[model samples]
Target: MAGLDDITNKAKEFLDSGAVKDALSSEQAEGVSDKLLDGVADAAKKVSGGKFDEQIEGARDAADKKVGNE
Candidate 1:
C-alpha cells in the first residue's frame, strides 16, 4: 500500500521541485496554459449545450490552478 501511495503522487513531487516550478511559471507556459484551459472550457460548454455556463467557468478556474503557472 505504501509503495503504491508513493507511486501515485508523482505530480506532487514534480510540483515541489523548485526548477520545475520555475519552468512552469515561464512566459511560454503561461500562454500554453491559457490556450489549454480556454479550449477545454469552450468544448465543455458546447457539449453541455451552454446550460451549465456558470459551473463550467468554475471548473475552468479549478483546472487552471492545476495546470496554470500561478
Candidate 2:
C-alpha cells in the first residue's frame, strides 16, 4: 500500500509540473498534433527506405487521432 501510495503521489506531482501543464496547454491548436506525427512518420519512412511508408502513415494517422485536440 505504501508503494502504491508513493507511486500515486509521484504521478500527481508529475501531472502538476509546469512542463506538463505547458505541454498540455500548448498542443491544443488544430493540426499541430498531426504535424508532429507527420514529422515522426517521415523519419520512420526514411529509416525504412520507404518500404514501410504506408504502414508508417497509418500509424501516424492513428497517433494524430489519439493525441490531437482538434
lDDT of 1 by residue, 1-70 (tens): 9888887688789779998878777877878998988998999999999999999899888877766466
Report the alpha-carbon TM-score of model 1 versus the true structure.
0.73
The model with the greatest lDDT is: 1
- In candidate 1 the C-alpha lDDT for residue 57 amounts to 94
Worst ten in a row by lDDT for model 1: 61-70
Q: Residues 26-52, candidate 2, lDDT per residue (tens digit)?
A: 556336776777788889998999999
TM-score of every model? 0.73, 0.57
